[model samples]
Target: MLSRSSFLAVIATIAATNVVAAPFTYVNERFGTVCTFPDDIFTDRQPEPDNGDGQQWLSADGASLICSGILNIDDDTPKGFVAAEKASSEPGYKVTYSKASKDWAVLSGLKDGNIFYERRLFGRDGVIRTVWIEYPPAAKSKYDPLVGAIAGSLKAR
Candidate 1:
């Protein structure tokens, strides 16, 4: 048998471990569209920086309609796009990258219907930003936490 305090401790541990907060939306920018999110995270980069693999860039035209607006990825930084993706719910690698930066973000009509969303941070020098993409599409749902952190750090213009 456990003492009252011990029992409470066990319950507290379980509760603490299970507790989860909802995901937040971040600043999203486009032609004339802009939005904000607080729970999300954002980070600053050198404009020309490398996450790990490919050199990150502001590119033009890709699967993501986002490129049509302010930023673009040239030779996309390795797993940079995953900033918009979450951990593998299915079974796969922790992260993957384009053999090339051509496909910054993609929504393959593979599953049934596909949807995408994004947020951007603006600046005077250029445009520092964070973008997220989703399927059923939402803030915390399938969104990447790393991206959320990066988004949280964004300095809006």
Candidate 2:
């Protein structure tokens, strides 16, 4: 029941639809919102792997940096992680990685993407329990400092 032009126009529009890049949300709560981060602006990078380096994305404000490092649990530990932390109600190592944490909220895909492992720790009113989304160095070119900062600034509500 549609005209040829109308159908073509619809098809064209569909073809041209480019999904906007949404911000990657890692964590959010009464504490704060953590997302994809911006890197330090003062630093320089390799455009094409100069000296074996690679390219990276800069943050809008540019102070802290997010760089991908190798994903190795054997040789890595969570930053600012506390030996004793808390969750809804369980006795674990403070914070533990579970794709099914009620705390993650809608920050989905934290376990399905380049995030290799999630390091967890607990926080309280005036303390910090940091977590990490480990990825390879190649992915380091796309570090999410907002996410890191969120992990760095978490506390129990």
Show model 1 residue runs off by greater than 4 Å. 1-112, 137-157
Whole-model Cα lDDT per candidate? Answer: 0.31, 0.31
**Top candidate (TM-score):** 1
| Model 1: lDDT to the true structure | 0.31
Q: What is the TM-score of each candidate against the true structure?
A: 0.24, 0.23
Task: Report the lDDT tens digits of candidate 1 across residue range 1-157.
Answer: 2334533443343334343322222223333222222221222112422322111212121222121134343433324544434444543323333221323232221122334344343433343343444333333332333233322333332
Cα displacement (Å) at residue 16, model 2? 26
Error of 2 at 1 (Å): 50
